[model samples]
Target: MPSTKIGILETGGPPRELAERFGDYAAMMRRMLGEGYAYATYDVADALPATPEEQDAYIVTGSPAGVYEDHAWIEQLIGWLRQAKGRAKLVGICFGHQVMAEAFGGRVAQSDKGWGIGLHRYQLHERTEWMDHAAAIAIPVSHQDQIVELPPFSRIVGGSDFCRVGILAYEDQPAISFQCHPEFEPAFAKALIEARRDRLPDPDAAIASLDQPDDRERVAGWIRRFLDGLAAERS
Candidate 1:
């Protein structure tokens, strides 16, 4: 069989200094995803894919910006996602997750809970075969926004008190998204916390939490198995 074509729809990236050390968000995702598949990246600030359906699947990367921000490219990306739904599989992370929810009749905004850093745990509500039947998970997270309202036909995969819409799977679409960052290595997660020390309420605590065992590979497994399902279906 041929390699699956995976597109990286990048909306934002790490700080320039941190990126030099940890690689950009796309690179981090690629490392987590491993090899054997082909990848194409589109910097959404520059442009979205001319053909949304060209890739067998797309993994939307985390961004520093909010989904409600008035950016032309951000709006365009949402429109493209609407067109791409069901045409190709999508896996959204952080901002990607928020944007997908906003595009699909949901709402996203800065959480009153403030910044959520470190490894946050979520109770899995329901599991599909692709999820490997996991009932709970704790993955790296760095965000101030989350999906507050769910889209129609959305199924809850997992959630926690801090972020109710942490993980979601659509009933009528071949798509799923997570508010956590499975792509973040412990080092990168720590560095990100340190970089934003001024903005975070408890950077030291957040950085300390990174030392605990996390479910990075566990979430990555869910993503890999979920995406691998697309290979057999794609032409």
Candidate 2:
């Protein structure tokens, strides 16, 4: 196997100063994905990729911007996604997940159930070759939007009470998306939870929940296998 280069489509970032200290989502992804993969980040929130062929694979990061927002960049990103279609393996996290859902004819909105912060457990309902384990896995989550409908040719892989479309794969597309953040370290999850503490419905509870153990590494392994498998299939 030759070297693999993956593109990080950065939709948003933490506070500039905090991002400097802790690094951004792209950096976190690189750290988790290890050295076998080379990464290039396109601040798609700021600028869209010049061409769909620029990146071999793409990982869309979480964002503060809602998928339903009237943003040109968001539209551009979706257009790029449509262009790439089945040509590349795409993975989305949090906001990325929501946007992908919406772009694929599904719907995404601010959940009436409210915000989900800290560790969340999603039960794996369907198994694919990309996953090594199943049942239930706890992962760091920080999102208010939820995927409410299934797109054409979509299959649900995992879910829970809070988020029905927790994990999904398109039958005709080379893509998998997660509603949780496997790239998030405990400290980063804690920091994000704390930063939004005042806005959260239960600050104390959310803070306390951060201490709970998570399956971050396990989820990371799943993502790694999924992408690697996609690459192999393509090759």
Candidate 3:
């Protein structure tokens, strides 16, 4: 059997240390999907493919930049997503999720409520065939911006008090968006926190909180199950 080729649209703002230590997001995804799966990354903010014809799946990764930033390629990416909505399976994480929402007639803005960092709990409001298997899970979160409003026909799959639109699914389409960064491990998250420590309100507290191993494992389990669900749905 041929390998499944997944397309990854990386927004390219990852810290150099974190990227070097954890490897690229595509590498982590390849590990998650096991063998018989491969991924290719594209800088959607720079260029996106003319079509999704060659890929089995597509994922949009997180970025430090906001979706509303004045970038020419960002508009093109939104257009690409609109065109490929139902034809392909799309998973948007962090900035990708925000961009997808904005692209699909939703709104994204920086929260005056401050950042949602460290491990957080999210509850699933209603059971769906896609996320019913894992209703409530504690996932890692570290975002300053969020999707304030959802696009047409989007359903809330999961959420916390800080983020009402944690996980969203497009109506009848095999597309999913996440406000948290499920791709991050504890080490990677801590690395990021340390790198951006000066900007945080309480950097010491945040680092101390992330020192626990159990929380990291729990979050990892949640992500594994979530990704498993996606793969099952596609199959």
Top-lDDT structure, candidate number: 1
Where does model 3 exceed 4 Å of error? 212-235
Clashing pairs in 1: none
Off by more than 4 A, model 1: 230-235
Show the colliding residue pairs in model 2.
none
Query: Clashes per prediction?
Result: 0, 0, 0
Ordered by TM-score, highest first, the candidates read 1, 2, 3
**What is the per-residue lDDT of model 2 for residues 80-150, given as tens digits with 9 covering 90 to 100?**
88877788888999998888888788888899999988888899996677775458988888898999888
lDDT of 3 at 34: 52
In order, candidate lDDTs are: 0.89, 0.84, 0.74
Which 10 consecutive residues of model 2 have the lowest summed lDDT? Answer: 226-235
Sliding window of 10 residues with minimal summed lDDT for model 3: 226-235
Model 2 per-residue lDDT at 149: 82
Summarize candidate 3's per-residue lDDT along 1-235 as a digit string, tens digits: 6666678887765677777778877665555455555668787766787787767668888878888888777878888988888777788888889998987889999998788887677787865554435557666778899898889889888898889899897786778788876667767777888898888868667666665543334333444444444332322
lDDT of 1 by residue, 27-91 (tens): 99899999988999999999888887789999999998998889998889999999987889999
Most accurate candidate by TM-score: 1
